[model samples]
Target: MNWLLVIVGAMVGAPLRYLTDRTVQSRHDSLFPWGTFTVNMAGCLVLGLLTGAAAAGAASSHLQLLLGTGLCGALTTYSTFSYETLRLAKEGAGRYAVANVAGSVAVGLAAAFAGAWLAG
Candidate 1:
């Protein structure tokens, strides 16, 4: 049952991530990997909201499993983000690569905080 949730969540989240990445990449002309940044920030927000809801006893364990373990695990993809950052660095876009890393971290944190506050 839990595994099913993870699989379903991954199915939804992965495509959403891909679409978001493609959309951002299409709009931006830079090699800064804005797609990764967007996804990570969005993922952080979702995770924070889930945490707040769980902490407030507004959600059940199964709901946590679905949202936190399944949805969040699927939504927050560190591997793709890392790969893109490295690719940018390897292509000699040092500043953009660094920005990708730093910006994602900073924005992700801020989004998470915002989501938690909103949910609370």
Candidate 2:
């Protein structure tokens, strides 16, 4: 049941991520991967909140698995982020690549922390 929930959550989260990426890309002309960044940040925030809620006994274990393992795992794409950064670097957008990596890591972490704190 837990695994099923996770799978369902992933199905929903992955499509949502893809759609969001496409929407942002279509709307923006910047070379920077704003879509990926936004999704990751949002995922971090949600994961933090879910974790905090779970820890506080406000959420059930199934909810945790569904949100954290499925939704967050799908939404927060480290692989995509890494690939984009590497592609940027390879394409000679070294500054953008570095900024992407640095900003995502720094801000994502902060967002997670903030979400956790707020949820708590």
Candidate 3:
């Protein structure tokens, strides 16, 4: 049952991630990988909220497994982020690569902390 919940969450998250990436990327004219950035930050915020809610006993274990593990696991892609950054650097967009790495880490952490604080 728990596994099923996770699978169901992943089903939704994977497609949603792809759709969001496409939509965001389509709107951007740069090679900064805005789509991946948006999804990763969103996933971090959601997972943080889930964690805080779970800590406050507002979220069930199954819900955590579904949203945090399965949904976020599929929604956030470290490999893609890494690949994109590497590609940017190799393609002479070193500044964008640095910005992506630094901004993603800093903003992602801040978003996660903010979500956790707000939820808790």
Candidate 4:
């Protein structure tokens, strides 16, 4: 049952993530990976909210698996982020690569913290 919920959540999250990335990337023509960054930060915020809900006993274990593990797991892509950054650096966009890394980490963290605080 938990696995099914996870699958269902992933089904929604994965496509939504792709769609979001496409929409966001379509707006920008820069070397910076705005799509990937947006999805990752959004994913962090969602997961943080879920965590806070769980901490407050507002979420059940199944909900956690569905949203946190399944949705967020498929929604966020560390591998893609890493690969994009590497590709940027290899393609002579070293500054953009560094900026992506630094900005993603810093902003992602802040978003997560904010989400948790707001939710809690």
Candidate 5:
């Protein structure tokens, strides 16, 4: 049952991730990976909300397994983030690489906290 839930969630999440990444990336002319950033932050916020809700007893373990473990796991891509940062650096866009790291960390944390607060 748990595996089924996770698979279903991933089935939805994977395509959502790809579509969202493409959609967000298309709008920007900059070399910075805005799509990856957006998805990561969104995933963090969603997981934060799920965690908070779980803590508050408003969410169940099944929900966490589905959305947090499966959906968020598929939605966020650390590999892509790392690859993009490395690509930026190798392409002589070191500043954007640094900014991407710094901004993603900072904003990701903030978004997670904000989501938790909102849910709680």
Candidate 6:
């Protein structure tokens, strides 16, 4: 049952992630990896919300597995982020690479905190 839920959730999340990345990336001319950053931050915020809901006893373990483990896990891609950052650095866009790492961390944390606060 849990595995099924995970697969179901991933079915939605994976396509959504790809579409979102393409939509966001299409708007930017730079190689700052805005798409990956956006997805990561969004995933963080969602996980925070799920965590808060769990803490508040509003979300069941099954729900957590489906949404958090399944959806968020599929929607966010650490591999892509790492690859893009390294690509940027290799292409001499070292500043952009650094910015991507720092910005993603700061913004992702803040977004997660905000989501948790809102859920709480």
- For each of the candidates, the C-alpha root-mean-square deviation to the true structure, in angstroms, is 1.3, 0.9, 0.6, 0.7, 0.6, 0.6
lDDT of each: 0.82, 0.90, 0.95, 0.93, 0.94, 0.93
Candidate 6: pairs in clash: none
Among these predictions, the greatest lDDT belongs to 3
Q: Per-residue lDDT for 82 in model 2? A: 96
Q: For every model shown, what is its TM-score relative to the native structure? A: 0.91, 0.96, 0.98, 0.97, 0.98, 0.98
Off by over 4 Å in 4: none
Q: Which residue runs does candidate 6 get wrong by more than 4 Å? A: none
**What does candidate 4's lDDT look like per residue over 4-73, in tens digits?**
9999889988998999999999999998989999999999999888888888889899998999888999
Give the Cα error of residue 94 in candidate 6, in Å: 0.6
Superposed Cα deviation of residue 54, candidate 1 (Å) = 0.6
Residues 16-118, candidate 1: write the lDDT tens digits: 8888889988999987877778878888999888778877888777777777777677767899889988998899988888888888889888888888888
What would the per-residue lDDT of candidate 5 be over residues 7-78, giving only the tens digit for each residue? 988988899899999999999999999999999999999988998898899999999999998899899999
Q: Compose the digit string of candidate 6's lDDT tens values, residues 1-120.
A: 899999988998899899999999999998789888989999999999998888899999999999998999999999999999999999999999999999988999998888888889
lDDT by residue (tens digit), candidate 2, 15-104: 999999889878889888999998999999998898788778898989988888898889889999999999999999999999999999
Superior candidate under lDDT, 2 versus 6:
6
Query: Between the candidate structures 1 and 4, which one is better when assessed by TM-score?
Result: 4
Check candidate 1 and list the clashing pairs: none
The true-versus-predicted C-alpha distance at residue 113 of model 3, in Å, is: 0.4
